[model samples]
Target: MSSASLKRLAVAVVAAAGAFALAMPTASATPARDNVKDKAEVIGKGKEKEKTVPVRLLSINDLHGNLEPPTGSSGRIADETGTVVDGVGGAAYLATYVKQYKNKDTVLVAAGDLIGASPLLSAAYHDEPTVEFLDMLGLSTSSAGNHEFDEGYTELKRIMKGGCHPVDGCSPAGKWKGSKFDFIAANVLDKKNKHALAPFYLEKINGEKVAFIGLVTATTPSIVTASGIAGLKFTEEVAAANRTSKFLAKRGVKAQVVLVHEGDQVTPNQSPDACPVVPGLGSRIANGLDAEVDLVISGHSHQAYICKVNDPKGNPRVFTQGSSFGRVLTQIDFQIDKNTGDIVRSSVVADNHVVRRTVTPDAQTVAFIDLWKSRTSAVANKPIGRITADMPNTASASGEVPLGNLIADAQLEGTKTGGNAQIALMNPGGIRAGLTYAGSSAGEGDGVVTYGEAFTVQPFNNLMQVVTLTGAQLKLLLEQQWVGGPNNQAFTKILQPSSNFTYTYSTSAAWGTKVSNIKIDGQPVTDAQTIRVAANNFLVGGGDAFAAFTSGTDLWSGPLDIDAFAAYLGAHSPVAPPVANHITVIP
Candidate 1:
């Protein structure tokens, strides 16, 4: 074996010995709360002037409040052979996997999206359960995702600082004690103080200090609700990481890692351990980082991969991401030079592991999930309606889906009670999951739809609104679905239109002219014609870059989106999948 390999093995042995010694019962038997002091004493024993230390980093991202096993496509895992494996992802299973891989040197962290857009189980209690779960898993630190600001900065602070919610008061979990982990945001700045929310977190591992810098995507403001980020500024990611690394260096900390909430898309069917052929934002950030920054962990795009991209100084550094919803966990191992407190760049290695359910689940997590499930059972189990078949949220080339169409139709019908709504448009991102024919739990029969299922489909609870828009403005809204628009979506986000609306768009046409042949009820919509449209307040406020919606007039507020959807389900029993022919795509 090479000298470097031998050195790494020795370091691992020492770390394992230290961990075993710490686990054994002693006379004093007092739990060690000071990590640095404990590590120093454990590694300081005879002939232990070793110049290297082994460190393990275990990470997960985009959990999105899935305390229970995710249903439908969200629960599946993809292997290197392009085969899909089912029945994965539950907090209990995740906890089991985390414990299996954890060692004394392990430092657990997450890139972002730990909560927000959560399922009804977690969302019912404002995601306090997820926070508790992370604390139990011993998360050391994490970055903030755009969804972290879903309820605004004050609520985010409440999540981090621990307290009863200002509005919802205390949950069944009682007064919230916030998260035990540090949430560091190097790029997110307080507009009033001109300082970062939580700039950097420092960890001392085996007598060496390591710095973790966290950052959200620079495009946070464009995607998140406007009011949620009114007083915060998200700066460029690379610059923020570079500046943070410089600051850490001045403090005599050289081992640096960046936990960013932005990531790149990988080719379909590729192995999670494969490097990208064409790098995206995550790769760009990793490649542009200063030499002092040794590693990057990313999330948001939800793609799983392990890559080695070159830094600005042409030295290769590790970059990795795990898929969303607790289905995968990334394990990164590296060696640090104890003398210099610098990471051995050549010793870094990373791999993605599937959270397979075959193993024994953590009993505590299972009971915790059951506690929340029973608490929410009364409302969650109430029958909303029935379906003839599954209404999958999967979209086609034109971006239309059975569930999206149903949601838009429901919004239009619900809003028509007070406003003359002709059509409704639903953003694709708003649809979280699909309606399965086989119900989630016991007591519910096949094809039966419950309030929990409906809530899962539309969890945002955005208020419905009706507004008047000219036919000209409607065309602009359709054009905004593609690139070169204010939102700059990576792909075309075809708005899910109600049954009355039909439109065709040409892929070959120019940006503004891509959308053509717009109509309502098979009648051509004239440029000067004004139509009343039904949509969620998010769309009306120009969320997701559909700025044309902001120009609408004669606005009228309606019911919460989930309530409207539930009422629609109850009103129309035995609902069948809507024909996916609303939007036409021209080659």
Candidate 2:
């Protein structure tokens, strides 16, 4: 090991204590300028003393274009004590926090998922408002998350490069200006050219170089709609980041931070800030990182954590994630050596701050959100239907969720009239948010589900497709939920079935035999039986690793999934969360 590696090890040992300090509760909505020290430090008393520059990095992830304060569980985050705090995020609150923490040397960045699956105010304008929000926040750079590819690689380029939407033309807000910040992906490459979309971003702070290497999870292909990401290849996270770090090192840039769009969760009941270890891709990437790589800022699991993970040289390193939906922001402070221009690894300190609504929201951000809301309010505020209670997207042990079932039932009902659909299934991921009976901040009143609310739940606007699949193919589709199934899924992803269709699975059963007792309308489905199934086109294209859907015949396309959901809610006023008994799991 080099002298630098040995020194890092000693510093890491001391940083362990600072890592624990992150768990202490923060004062609600405390201004960053009040708490942070922005000055550089000079160590040693003699002429040998070296000066170091201080840099503050502020990060958030999975904002998902939430211009307004997210509602329900999405709006809350748990403290180290496991106590949940509510009313945490909104564009204004986030802006206030960012502004408070920002200094001349401060860099505001995002891990990924800044948009896509957005609120109607932003999504209606193809997330232009959200991009404008980021630019206004002065975000320096961000990695592209899986959701970034929702519309496809070409659309992502347009989002970063800026132009009027090819399909929607320019929104009422006016001509679209491209993002001011850099959107980079080190791992995602053009298959034909084998070149990254935007490899890495460089920032000069206080006459020192700080490099940010951006990467998305390789599993992106499995999770995202296949066609949207066509011609792009997502490489493994660790390898991509390490390779980029090496490239930067060769160029005399060594103060490196990886902004990766993949992460792991804190252990259950563990304080996100206090956990010493975590399990998942985030931890793996952090631990595997080269000694030259100073820190890892991650997202995707959407858990708030400020933890220390050992790098390859066994030197402790800061690894952190801010919880999703702008509810939390991770603050990382470090010193860069004046002579070496590399991060003082031991000087790294990280903490996760909740975007508490207690603070006065930034007036500019409030006006910005309201302006977009006005542009979309005519259709957004229209009452689509009523809901009896919250239909949360939270899934049961069997992976069946009330909202998922509701969406599947809606798709079945919508397609049955013209397409003659017998069964409907919905992917759990496609159900972004849930139906809440309480009124939104828009003042639509309780039990009234507005067009905006429905759009938030089903923002993909995926077209509904009804197709004929034999019972054998349906069984195969069910089996695909497990690890040994088609495409070798990393984990189980139980498909949500409509009320009329039911199935049972066993946890102990091996592979293809894990599922059985499939039925439609109380009748057993035989292998030779042909069933008409309804689902979004993304599923029919074999997204989420459910390849069986690709074999379906007699395909017929119909209404947008959101339209079906709205129509169903209209037909059944005050709709209730459907019983989550469509799927059963036996031990």
Residue-wise lDDT of candidate 2 within 301-408, one digit each (tens)? 878888888888888889888888898877899998988889998899888888899999999999888788788889999998898888887988788888898889
For TM-score, the strongest prediction is: 1
Worst 10 residues of 2 by lDDT: 28-37
The pairs that clash in candidate 1 are: 162-178
Candidate 2 colliding pairs = none
lDDT of 1 at 215: 86
The top-ranked prediction according to lDDT is: 1
Candidate 1 deviant stretches above 4 angstroms: 1-41, 44-47
lDDT of each: 0.82, 0.81
How well does candidate 1 match the true structure, expressed as C-alpha RMSD?
A: 8.2
Q: Model 1 reaches what TM-score against the true structure?
A: 0.92
